[model samples]
Target: MDKFFKLKENNTNMRTEIIAGITTFLTMAYIIAVNPDILSIAGMPKGALVTATCLTAGLTTIFMGLYANLPFGLASGMGLNAFFTFGVVIGLGVSWQTALTAVFIEGIIFIILSLTNVREAVVNTIPLNLKYAVTVGIGLFISFIGFVNSGVVIKNESTMVSMGNFTSPTVIIAAFGLFTMVVFYKRNIKGALLWGIAVSTIAAWIYAIIDPQGAAYYKIFLPEGVFKYESISSIAFKLDFSIFNDPSKIWTLVVVVFTFLFVDFFDTVGTLVGVASKANMIDKEGKVPGAGKALLVDAIGTTVGALLGVSTVTTYVESSAGVAEGGRTGLTSLVTGGLFLLAMFFAPLFVAIPGSATAPALIMVGFFMMENITKIDFSDFSEGIPAFLTIILMPLTYSIGDGLTIGVLSYVIIGLLVGVYDKGKKKVSNVMICLAFIFIIKLIVSGIG
Candidate 1:
């Protein structure tokens, strides 16, 4: 195992990797329920989506471990899934089957890019400061997600968002969990985040038992099931390619594919770099080893996921929890993949782990990701302004692509204005400038549409 994973070189043992895998799985397992619930809005059968999510996550995560030899987990992404249901199927009035076809085509594009070194070129061209910003930005994004999920923050009529009722039991338990995680992390405990989640979950379960109505109010409690076996026949291999036959729909298909490509491209890049930075896996050149393979597997996962009736499958940001837990090799990914495969039979049990429990781990991981801020050359306004924008816009816009796109544009424009290039070495790269213009055009087109 050491020889295979180079565990010693990575400074991790089998036991550490296994524990890290479990920790990562626990942090992200909510996707089993969440993906189905969201995608069902597009008229998909929830049961089939559950099965598809598990299969795609399991198979592709294992492939990532074995092929890329990286400890990242793959699943249906949160943002892309919402776009699939709400933006495409409902807003565009396209059929769910047609949406899947578009996703499949996007995956094919991704595969071509990965194999031809196009993806690698984009990764290598990103400036170092922006790279760090991506890490910190994703961290803040994760924390914001945790806060919203745990009801620590909520929408308000007066302000766009405001503090939630802290007295609520759900909020209270999540706060306690965050406190526990912080304390344990300070003490340098190995599985502090995991322990915090367990304790918080137990508290929630006890509260639910004591006050079933209150628990019902929050829609959180011990789910009553040991097993959940959902049939996949409804969506398995049910992709409809007939949308290509309609010439009138070609323009809509083009726009749909472009949207999928744009979001998936940046999301995968940001996530791979962010999670890798957490593990200190990127080299001095700011490149990840086996990036092409990792990206290929991700593309394959998306294609298969769409075929199996789910949205774009990509690397989850939650993998940072495993890195924080001392995972340094592919074994960690293997363990996570195995659990996802097993989750096919235990869906109900996995879904029972409430948001309040996982929120703490995400909060702590966000704390860890903030460490990258120190690496940014804050003295240089050219770098600092864009970095600052990246950090805020990620959570503020609730979109990684938006954060990255705007950050790139801001960096390039500011670099030009200051007459100082990245690292004072050269002018902003043409690729980034072109991408920024494309993003602006995309925004305009979206508004018009």
Candidate 2:
């Protein structure tokens, strides 16, 4: 195991990797319940989706470990799934089968891009400052997710977002967890994140026992049962290619495919760069090692996830929890993937680890990722402005892809101006110029549609 994963070389051991994997799984296990619930609203079976979600995540993550040798987890993406259901199915009045077909087609295009090195070239083209900004942006994005999940932050009528009631049990519990994590982390405790999650979950269960009504009101409760398994027979292999039959629907299909492609492409790229940056896996050239294989695995995960009845499967940002926990190799991914497989039978138990419990870890990881902000060359406005936009817009816009889009567009525009004005001040690559044009076209098309 050490030889294969190069444990000593990476300065990580099996125990640390194991804990990191468990931490990563705990942080993201919400998807097992959330995905099925969201997709079921689109008229799919919830039970079948639970099984498919686990199966796809487990297999894909394991493949990532073995093939890419990167400590990242792949699962059906949260935003992409919402888009599949709400944007495509409900808004466009398209059938669920057609949405899945679009995802599958998008996956095929991604696979081709990966194989042809188009995706790698794009990754290589991103400037180092922007890459650091992406890491910092993702840190804030995930931290915002933690705050919202723990009920520490609430939607406000007048202010847009406000603090939740301190009296709320969820808020109190998450605070306790955060406090615990801070103490342990200060002492250089190993598995501080895992410990925080465990402590908070225990506290929640105790609260549920003491005041069941309040617990239920706050959506905090013990597991209903153990050892439950759902079959994927109903939803697997369910893609419908009927959109190709009608000439009128073909245009809609094209639009749908493009949307999926654009979002997944950038989301994956941003995640890979951000998480890799945090892990110190990027080389001197600002290139992530084994990125090609990682992209291929992600593409394959999406294709297989579509066949197994889910949205686009991509590398998860929550994997940063593992990376922050000192996970440095594929071993972490293997352990994480193993837990996902185990979650199939123990779904209720795993799902019972409330979002509040994991919220602290994400918030802490966000703090860790913020260190990258210091690395950005903020003295240069040409670089500083774009980097600032990238960092601030991620959490504000609540979309990594959108933040990256605006950042890249601004970078290209600013660089072009600098080059023209100062003659030798800045040089924007042709790839970046083309990308800015593409982003403009995407925005225009989306608006027109």
Candidate 3:
């Protein structure tokens, strides 16, 4: 009986670790299911894109574990995906092949920046509140995307279809998923996220059975080129490089890559710093042991993913939810990586699992991000405004970089107004902040122009 009990405890620990990794991976899994819609807006075929998304993400997660040696997971970056698929492809009217080229060239630039330590120098310059704004903004952006995609926030010419139908399959499924996870969370179940996925999966299958358009939706979902329902099938195998003929496009590639690196640098840094604190991953020197290496790994992951025809790959803040569940070490990352690898092979299964099922997880993460708002020192308007900008604009602006720009600019402006400039020259942070502030001003001016 004693030996059996010991074995059980060991299994429980292992389970907790596994749960953590899976939860972290899941934070971005929805993208695997949905990125194709964005990527294919420029005529990217379905199968190839889905495969590329999964394969690249799975490979990058492994790299994060083995190379970075941190319990971090990687996938198609949240903000960059939309930007790559929307801002560049649709808004800028760039071809799909050109977009891939942009990602690839940018990945190479990132590699150079990280190895030369230039990226770190730039990153260390960003302020804490500005950083917080980036992470929280990502959370809000993520929830926004989820809500919008689930058909909850449809944009009508007059007004957006911005709420639930209550009777819609996606709506009902998401609600059920949210309710199930909330109950599980309140009940203090270990791996509530995992349970939520499971419950949601069953619910989706049940919904499909009862869906009025069951056959049609299922067929549309089972289209030829999907890895999961949302991403392209051959995302890793489909980088068509024919769009580099134009000199203007080539130069534009340079601009895109740098911009991606800048945004991703702050996004990954802020998320890791914030979530690591919550997960107790930080050590005495205000660092996690393999944190820098983990970042380097993330950069590499993005490089490889870009090459593989997917968007940027970066460490997810959602992984911290697993830390809350007691995840620790490379073991957790390895487990999550394994789950991702396995899930790719079973794309249909993952696709069949509705995202509404994960809505609860998102709502839960929102609650966590909101907690950071309390840590802001509200006594001084300077500190208070910047912090408030971080918390509110993150969700409101729906872009991490957008919110970060506002947060840092506000901090500097407010500080100058209140005479709280912490003068320094040796520090890289001040330099980055100064540069960032200038760039943000340029962006604002350009927007006005």
Candidate 4:
């Protein structure tokens, strides 16, 4: 295992990798319940989606470990799944099968791009400062997710977001969990995040036993069964290609395909950059090692996920939890993927792990990722303003892709202004210029559509 994964070279051992894997799985296991619930809104079978989600995530994550040799986990993306159901299927009046087809097409295009080095070129072209900003942005984005998940932050009409009731059991549990993590982390305990999650879960279970009705109200409780499995036959291989035959729907199909392509492409890039930056996986030249293979695996994961009846599968930002736990090799991904496979039969148990339980791990990992923010040079406005926007907009906009889009666009525009005002002072790369134009077109088309 060490020979293959180079554990010693990466300064990580099997035990650390295993704990990291478990930590990553715990942080992201919410998708087992959430993805199915969201996609079922588009009339897909919830049971079938549960199975397909696990299957796709398991297979693709394992593939990532063996092929790309990265510790990142791949799963049906949260935003993309919501877009598949609400944006394309309901709002655009496209069939679920057709939406899946669009996803499949996007995957094919991504595969081609990955193969031709287009994706790698883009990754290498991103400035180092912006890359650090992405890491910090994702850190804040993840922390926000943790806060919302734990009910520490609640939606409000007047203020947009407000504090939740401290009296809420979920909030109490999350606070205890966060406190536990902080203490363990301060003591330099191994698997502190994992311990935090375990403690939170136990506390939640205790609360459930004491007050079953209240526990159920907050959606916190024990699993109903030890073994449960759903077959994916109902939803698998259900892609609809009829959109190609209908001339009237061709424009809609094109739009849907472009949207999927655009979001998945940049979301994957931003995630890879953010998590890799946190892991120190990027080289001194600001290029991610084995990036081509990683991108390829991500593309293939999406394709296979579509075939298995799910949304686009991309490298997960939650993998940062594992990296924070000392995971540095594909061994972490291997263990994580194995857990995902196990989750297929143990669905109820994994799903019963309340979001509040995992929220602490994410929150702590967010802090670890924020350590890179100081690396960005704020002295140069051409670099500083864009970096600031990238960092702030991620959590505010609640979309990594949108944050990167605006950041890159601003970077190019500002760089141009600086160059025009003081020649040779700032020079934007050709790639950045091209990307800025593309983003502008996308924004315009989205507005018109």
TM for every model, in the order presented, reads 0.96, 0.98, 0.81, 0.98
What TM-score would candidate 1 get against the native?
A: 0.96
For model 1, how does the per-residue alpha-carbon lDDT over 1-449 read when each residue is reduced to its tens digit?
89998999999999889988998999999999899999999999998888889888999999999988899999999889999999999999998988998999999999998899888777767788888898999999999888987899999999999999899887888988999988887898778878888988898888988999889888787877878788888877767777768898888899999999889988898888788877887789877777788889989998888888889999999999999899988899999999999999998888888998899889888989999999999998888999899889989999888898888888878877666534566478877777778878878987897
Candidate 2's residue-wise lDDT over 25-97, tens digit each?
8888999989998999999999889889999999999999988878999999998999999999998999999
lDDT of 2 at 21: 90
Write one digit per residue (lDDT tens) for candidate 4, span 36-131: 999999999999998899889989988988887789999999999999999999998888999999999999999999999999999889999999
Q: What is the lDDT of residue 265 in candidate 1?
A: 89
lDDT of 3 by residue, 55-103 (tens): 7777777776666545667787776888887778887787766777777
Q: Is candidate 1 or candidate 2 better by TM-score?
A: 2
Report the C-alpha displacement of residue 285, candidate 3, in angstroms.
Answer: 6.3
Question: lDDT of all the models against the reference?
Answer: 0.88, 0.93, 0.65, 0.93
* Residue pairs in collision within model 2: none
Q: So what's the TM-score on candidate 3?
A: 0.81
Which residue pairs show backbone clashes in model 1? Answer: none
Report lDDT (Cα) of residue 34, candidate 4. Answer: 96
> 174 in model 2: Cα distance from truth in Å?
0.7
